[model samples]
Target chain A: MTNVLNKAINEKPVTTGMLLALMAATAYGSSQFLAKQIVTEIAPPSVVATVGLFSGFVVLMGLSIGNLPKDRKAPKKAVVFLILSGIASSAGVTFLYTALELAPVVIVAPVSSVTPLISLSLAHIFLPKMESITAKTWVGAILVVAGVSLITIGSHI
Target chain B: MTQAIIFALLAALGWGTSAIFVRLGLQNLTATPGTAISLAVGTILIGIVAVTAHGPTAFNLNPNEFAWIVLLGVLNYVLGRYLNFNSVNLAGISRSAPLLASAPLVAVAMGILIGGETINSFILLGTLSIFGGVILVATGGGRG
Candidate 1:
């Protein structure tokens, strides 16, 4: 059992990564539906965001406590970036919950999923070495924007 | 409707930029600590907002609501985020990103099945186009 576990962990990173990504997407995607239900029943979007994030923080803190001593000495820059990232993500969650309150899950999910296009643009500008924007990427981005436009327009009609 | 779409786009922008920051920070920290710190920070920020907007009562959810919130936190923040960070570490953001973007597909299906969300051909077409575009961007074949 240990050898099997080790082999799975060590053998194929790309495959494992893809699988993990898929699983994450599924969990996150389904979350919108659940979130919609929660918001309808209880608190507002801000409260939901706060409670959910705090619960998550508690869980992650518990899980990470063992590594905290060694990891606490991270560079100041990384800490700053992570804090900023957290702020940004908090805003995202707030907006997402607001959107969910206003619209159906199907409509809100696809529209918000366009994060990749924005991420790609940011990567091109900030971290060129990390990701280079190609013609295909441009086309893809255009298609995504166009699709989002269509959905928005169509939903109104 | 327009308001909802705008808010959703804002969310996209926030999440998109957050990914870059996470990647940058991950350079110095591993997934576990990085996730813990970021989530803790985000929670505090959101908690502040919640307090200011709705007062301390904002945290006063019903027992069922609290349970649901806990479940959501576990599912999305703990499991979902852990997988996402690990995927980025392993596959690089460029490759793992589009796959992550595919979350909408799952959401749409689940929404219809569980949430009773109705879908039209327009929505179908839009989803297909978005998925196609995300794939193109992910496999852009650019210099790494």
Candidate 2:
């Protein structure tokens, strides 16, 4: 993984931050399917959500403890964003699992797959530096929408 | 269809916003703390949901169900996610995204083998098409 990131960073043309963002996107996409498997066993959506968030918290905390600076204090703004992100993520995972519970795996999969599309679009509107719509993006968006539709249709049977 | 679609869209918005926030929060802290902090907040939120959704029943889970939840909490939430984030950190989004996208295909296989779900012709077509679409996206044109 670091090799890929290094390539993205050292390559004259590609920026490291952009490369990082892309990595985040890929993680987002892959998480959906793996999550689907777990969610199947832990129904009620909320249980899955709780377990996921709690476990992620525990693991991240355990690994990071020794590295903390003794005098460090979190800035108020970052704290706000952290809490907001947490709220948004909790809501997102809950809704995602709700969709999964109601619909077939195939159906839920594509619906949430629209995430990149929405995120990119919203990023264009808000974080203009992060991304902009282009012809290729349009094509990709169309394909994703079509793919999602096909999945939904296929799942009905 | 309407309800599911709406729920999914809501999920997308929440996740998208969270992604942005995760990036922002990471600016100041190390990845581990940032992930843990956000997850802790989320866990509290989920606890609220469990309480409201099941009330007293939430406390009465059977031993089997509780065990599965704990195992899943560790494996799926902690281990699976850590690997995922690490994969992104290592591979870059482009290479990583495609690998991650393979999850759906993996899910299809799991469903058949583990869930005892049968696939028809439609599933084959849909899965293939989804993969094709994802490939196009991962290559992400220089545009949005």
Candidate 3:
């Protein structure tokens, strides 16, 4: 058992990525749960957002602080894109946290999880050279819409 | 109810666009520095909003709430995002995308089990549908 586990763990990229992705899912889900805990009437979304984002930034900086110098050498265009990404990410987080403050996770999680569909569509339009989308992706989008609708109806019922 | 939906949609839009920017940035740079730079910018932006909205009163939380907030930051921002970046970097997007899509399921389960949210067949089926659809949509996007 130990040998099997060790072998699986040792596999490069594939196994490691699977483990990391799984860990990420758990962390993200748990974060939403934690956000719900603090985002009450007593502490508004903005308040919690500020504290949480600050703390997160601080922690991340500590871990990756060594890479700060490399960022300076990166192409200006890359830096600019990263800055834009940051701003957008901030907006996304603020809105999602606020939504959690207002609704149950059942509604908010699935709703916000639709980020992929929109991202893919945007990639097709803006980053067309980078990636291509197929009919299947659109079908998945339709399914996502249907699922969201059902969740809404369920919420109401 | 409407507010929640609208906010969630906006969040989706912002996050979706952010993903595009990250990709563009990655054309010239690696993920760690890119993410660090972007997150730094985001933190500053969010900081300004917090001050404008709350006027520095947000720091008065009790110990429990404070701890929860810290935990949220570390778990979501640090662990969740960092692991995700490494996942895509290592496994390629196609294989990892399906797993990342599972986040909603984890959140939903925790919400029902620990957060005391109520649910029914519609909610269950809907959640499952979205989960499947997200997997399909994300994976269907050519393997990163």
Candidate 4:
């Protein structure tokens, strides 16, 4: 564990992937507030999701054109995972944007915050080797759930 | 409050799992294809549902509405999705998820500054608690 820590620390300041993730998280986190604003003007959650997905698809496709992996075509197995994941992603966004449409950003944001707990729990159940559920994790998970609940309570005001 | 909270919780669970699924799916394809394909699939599904429920013109909208939708979609979905997938790949979900969740605070600030929204006592307390709890969970990781 110490060695792993040292290796991670000693690595180059930041990798492109890590930078992208941080950017993505911040961008996503901010979207709650933005979506809340836009949904006020636009009524249907499906419309919001559809438009957003199409725009994102076009943008990503455009960006990816010159960067295609110089390797074999995407595996069929990967396509299946991508489809399943697409559903999950779409479902998440649908709920998120819909929630934003209905409530304040502050009220809606915390609910999505508990995502880690869910992912971790699901990972524990489905991918045991990848993640360990320790007592601390359970406690943290509980706190996230409870904290989100309180945020909901606050939203009623 | 309860209903809104429930909705948010539902959203969070979905978002959290979405992160996991993105990581899982990215393993199978190039980042670009993976992102585009995923969004395309989702958009199609959503389009079908909207059309079925509302009719063929479900997607019909004014240019102004379309602009906002497109911009938000690009910012949050395209840009955000790419960054997030990369972050998970780099930092791992443990660090990435918590930081990502901190976005509520950002929204709170934006709400105050732009939305002319005021935070009441309960909201103040709740927001503080949420941040405090997040700090605990994040720092508990023992690295940062």
Q: Which segments of candidate 2 are over 4 A away from where they belong?
A: A1-43, A70-72, B119-123, B141-144
lDDT per residue as tens, model 3, B1-144? 768878988999999999999988988887766777777787788888888887877668888778888888889877888889888978889889999999988998999999899888988888888898999899888633
* Per-residue lDDT of model 2, residues A1-157, tens digit only: 9787567656732345444434444444445544665566645788767866676677667788887662147676776778888899789889988886776555565556556666676667777776767766677777777766666566666
- Compared with the true structure, all predictions reach lDDT values of 0.86, 0.66, 0.84, 0.70
lDDT of 2 by residue, B1-144 (tens): 557767877987897888778767767766667667778888888888788887746545677666665655565456556656665665566766666656566555655665566666765766676666665565573443
What class would a CAPRI assessor give candidate 2's docking? acceptable
Q: Which pairs clash (backbone N, Cα, C closer than 3 Å) in model 1?
A: none
- TM-score for candidate 2, residues paired by index: 0.78
Chain B superposition TM-score per model: 0.85, 0.78, 0.87, 0.73
- The residue ranges of model 4 lying beyond 4 angstroms of the native Cα positions read A1-26, A67-72, B85-98, B132-144
Q: Write the per-residue lDDT of candidate 4 for residues A16-64, one digit (tens) a residue.
A: 4455555676676667677888778775787788888899988888887
Q: Which stretches of candidate 1 lie over 4 Å from their true place?
A: A1-18, B85-99, B141-144
Q: Give DockQ: model 4.
A: 0.46
Q: Which consecutive 10 residues in model 1 chain B have the weakest lDDT in total?
A: B135-144
Q: Among these predicted structures, which one has the highest DockQ?
A: 3
Every candidate's DockQ is: 0.68, 0.37, 0.70, 0.46
Query: What is the Å distance of residue A33 in model 4 from its true position?
Result: 1.8
Instruction: Write one digit per residue (lDDT tens) for candidate 1, span A1-157.
Output: 8687457658987877878889899999878888888877788998898888888889988888898877888998999999999999889999999999999888888888888788879888899888887889889989998889888877876
- Index of the highest-TM-score prediction: 3
lDDT of 1: 0.86
Better of 1 and 4 by lDDT: 1
1 or 4, which is superior by DockQ? Answer: 1
